[model samples]
Target: MNLSSSLMACLALAPLAQGARLSDRLESAHGRFLDDRRGAFTSLSDPFGVPPLAKIVLEDPRGRFSGPESWHRNVVSTVFWVGELPSENNPTPNTASAWDGNWQANFGGYDHPEKRDGFLPTGFVPALNPFYIALPYNDIGRDGRHRPEASTVIPWFWEDYRGEGISVCKDRWVAIHHEGRVCYAQWEDVGPFETDHFQYVFGKDAPRPNRNQNAGIDLSPAVRDFLGLRSGESVEWRFTHDREVPAGPWRDWSPEPGLPRR
Candidate 1:
């Protein structure tokens, strides 16, 4: 069937999806998604019926889409960390983050962007959760002031804003898909390059062209390992609420105190 027919089937069978896999219900209707990750599927574009992350949004009465704020498909992703040294490929060392002046210290150690011990750094245990990522947009500006566009561009701005000091984007959980695996991570820092591309971050637009293969997001080693991703790979991702995060290795480590857990 086509996309519209598949959607109609989804709504008609919504009750059946309860306490059962939605992917299974939609499989007969759409037959487009085939991934085995948590019964979720991957797609090349939108409205190809609902992927698992979008399933959560559809189930939640409060998270209904008002615009193009669902999954960002086929985005180029790169790897980065708290103390990644400056190099030819990476001009900006991550000694300090856009929000945290002492990112390494706060994170409790060097992330060793490359070294991995099965979803974690080989040398040390991270004081915070190892699963983290960075998007290309920063809500705060270089002038140490919240950007004017942040309030309007970010969907959760009003709901998540604590004050000017805390970032609405920081530590926000995201669900990522690569191959057949889906891994969860937090938004800890910003950039593979640009930091003002909110249009692409929260709106419907492609990533701005950049040197790093137009990387739209940066993943931590833990996220990279869990997703089995190479340095530059295409993946699908979407902002997810803490309550929606599923049980996985991402929760095997500790998150900073007071942060949400699933």
Candidate 2:
């Protein structure tokens, strides 16, 4: 089925998706997604270039259509995710404890090393992103122990697109809205579980629960405090790019994103 068809099936299939495993749903829909992390949608292209209602396209089988798409100001994306953060162990703990020291072995959560210097602002809460969220595995993967870090930033998963989703490395901007509050954050890492859910992350497909948890998105400590988010808190977040981002507490921390960089 095409992207349109998949969306059409969403409302009807949403009920069935509850308590469903990621693999089971994919197998049932005959949906062809890139399972292994060898080569997911890591292209450094303008994800918004592809217009939703356009006619021509060129992408892989699972629908990454690569022609000239549209530039929608407000992308049709609002993910319903349980806010998760990089804590000490698997199935993230309710509150934060000490780093336990193992930063790279088990839940590896690192951000863009290139723009790492000025990533966080002065007196930034949680001190720094506490984990190493590198490639292949964005967030601390499921069933692993992670010793958190203070000077280092913990991973927060994001889309790999410019001007639409993740614009720069850890410098990408995002507006996280929960309850009545709207907080700005950087696109730092990925996955609370099931790392390769591009269809739901980038695309407008309804957000689904992870196999181990229902966490569709994870927030850094700064974001959690600003938004007053408790553990297992529900939130609605979207890719805010550069310009669309408002002038607020998060704007001054790092250099602005969106324009082509050197």
Candidate 3:
């Protein structure tokens, strides 16, 4: 079957697999798996109930403190080109070039440096300590009803410093936040530390209170030269944590056979 047909099949079968309704299943599943115990700085809040784009602007100009609602509705919308659907009034872009143009117009001109002011917004106080923003994306799935391939994109943001620049890091763990709960796909072996330190490149254009080192790395000149990462090039750090695999669904998946479990 074609992709559309396959997706239709999945959607059709979704309601028949369990005793609960779809909404109930989703709520139950999310409740069982999501974690929300990080503290009062982590923005592990729900995004589904957020007001629509128009309503948000009208309701709160500064946004009621930075969180996933700000990230998805504002940041993602500002950065990515949300495509139009096929409807009576809208026509889809024909080629990748057309789409690229739309995307560029949507995000290219925004003052990213201004937006990167001190990680979270200035006035917004976090609700959880050791706050983390988990970004999860499907690397292998197409737009429609195909089973996603074995690929994952998991990035995290942790507040390690007490300054404006928020220290963002990439970990091997699959971080997920659903229904006010967070879940982590623990890695068998921790990966290298990858940090995102792009705020320092804009010179005076960079954000203020630049004394913090957690957000930006002080890499050696030789290493910087080797990587072709210029002074202002956006850089990110990645690191691994030492933790044993929990006995659960992922017990069999290991970095290697007979390797010491991290």
The candidate that wins on TM-score is: 1
Q: How many residue pairs clash in each candidate?
A: 0, 20, 23
lDDT tens digits, residue span 114-138, model 3: 2333322133322211111212221
Runs in model 2 lying further than 4 Å from the true structure? 1-170, 206-208, 256-262
What overall lDDT, based on C-alpha atoms, would model 2 receive against the true structure? 0.40
> What value does the lDDT take at residue 75 in candidate 3?
11
- Residue 93 in model 3: lDDT: 26
Ranking of candidates on TM-score, top first: 1, 2, 3
Q: After the best TM-score superposition of candidate 2, give how far the Cα of residue 112 lies from its true spot, in angstroms.
A: 20
TM-scores for every candidate against the unseen true structure = 0.71, 0.39, 0.17
Candidate 3, superposed: residue stretches over 4 Å from native: 1-119, 126-137, 140-148, 151-236, 242-262
- Cα displacement (Å) at residue 21, model 2: 88
lDDT for each candidate structure: 0.78, 0.40, 0.27
Once fitted onto the true fold, the runs of candidate 1 whose alpha carbons sit more than 4 angstroms away are 1-69, 253-262
The CA lDDT at 29 in model 3 is: 45
How many pairs in model 2 have backbone atoms within 3 A of each other, for residues 3 or more apart or on separate chains, i.e. clashes? 20
Candidate 2: tens digits of C-alpha lDDT, residues 84-145 = 33443244431222222342222233322222233332332222333112111232323333
